[model samples]
Target: MTLTLRQPSMLTGMDIPSATQPTPEPAIHVRGLEKSYKDLRVLRGVDLDVARGSIVALLGSNGAGKTTMVRILATLLRADAGTARVNSLDVATRAADVRASISLTGQFAAVDEILTGRENLVLIARLRHLKDPGGIADDLLARFSLTEAGGRRVGTYSGGMRRRLDIAMSLIGNPPVVFLDEPTTGLDPQARLEVWQAVRELAAGGTTVLLTTQYLDEAEQLADRIAILHEGRIVVDGTLGELRRLLPPATVEYVEKQPTLEDVFLTLVGAGTEQGQR
Candidate 1:
């Protein structure tokens, strides 16, 4: 149970250790969840399970329906067919219960521009009917390292700072399942790392996480199990090493000392594929 220090500059990604086997008692589960708009069926019989206290990553190509799935699970949208449950509460039928047990941080940060960091959290706490609104705000600021700048308006904060505050506010009620839909999408390198760190800490604190990201490295670093969605269905699901074993890590192989992977033709690769690991 010894702890070690991590060099900040070394890497900036959420690293959920790969699980040895499929987890049990998933915090969130979906069965044949399907969604459609007009003629386009975005989600087709999508099934996924995220175990309690573990981080599950959804890796997929563009238009693969990752975000749509997240929306359904978050109760932001209803499914055309099938069912989704958070902590065993149906997202469609028991939305109030489901929402109370889960928090969703969409791709964009949702902080109020007029409110300061502390005020933003305090506002959310009040809405959640939490006791000691002042204490909750202080704890969130301190936990997210915003105590120093918390007094400044959220609009004055940096992109990373605003994102941190948004995430902290999401936890005002300490929900068990948190869905982060591309949480680091628009962040710069450093800001992305900060969000990743917050996610790692959340998982370590025993919160079940279901995250969707276009960044494969992010999933590799933070996901206990990785699921690849293709054409609205799960094409592959396993640990990093398992998926790597399923297919060549990348299309181009090393020519001993060939050109860098940068210029290599990447026609279509999983968002998490890396070079030199084939």
Candidate 2:
């Protein structure tokens, strides 16, 4: 695919703080974060900061400790060194508080296939001890454009629809920070687009997002800033423009433009609505 690096619009409430105003603390912060299993060091003194109400993509190749970073931040795993915080709560010292303030969406969709979309949402809301679970379910269904499929079994829903439902469920308690570990790992182009839009909406609603993906285009299309993790540490961190500056300017050459596989496949099959007609 002919992937051009274009700037994505900043999410709402993600503007730089004025000089008159004190800068708000980043929603996610890490300093000297490290992890290891036996003799295999997974992370080595990694540091990063994700601004509130913004999307920060952590790019890395397979086994680059991307998932390990997310796990430590999400309070699912303990870090052997360094400090990390989510929403001003320490992931190590205050694991419970950090867990309450954030949600983690893994690579796979975590939905019950036997249940309908609405049922799955309601179940999560109740598990979080929220009131009006039914109402919350209805609201999320409409927000993710799943109202029509709300009553249908998730087993019958398309990949995109199931993923949307999983994300909606994660927002049950309105967590301030969200960790998406390769959210589009196995999805097709259409499903990836669906998740991208859902993530954009999350940022618009003032949620901080730390997205881990190996897809360069995904980071280019969605992140306010991109952090590249290499050899268990962040090798680079900056906006897309800043990262682009690291490389020399592209040479201008004229060549016949050809349709990318993505373009041709999408053109031939066409895009689908959120319903994703299972």
Model 2: colliding residue pairs? none
Per-residue lDDT of candidate 1, residues 19-114 (tens digit): 543544467888898899889998889888787778989998778899899988988998999988788788999898788778889888988999
Worst 10 residues of 2 by lDDT: 1-10
Per-residue error at 218 for model 2, in Å?
A: 0.5
- Model 2 ranges off by over 4 Å: 1-21, 274-276
Top-TM-score candidate index: 2
- lDDT scores for all predictions? 0.78, 0.85
Residue-level lDDT tens digits of model 2 in 11-86: 1223332234356678888999989999999999999999877899999999999999999999989999999988
Supply candidate 1's per-residue lDDT for 170.
77
- Name the lDDT value of residue 198 in candidate 2: 89
Off by over 4 Å in 1: 1-24, 248-278
How close is every model to the real structure, measured as TM-score? 0.81, 0.90
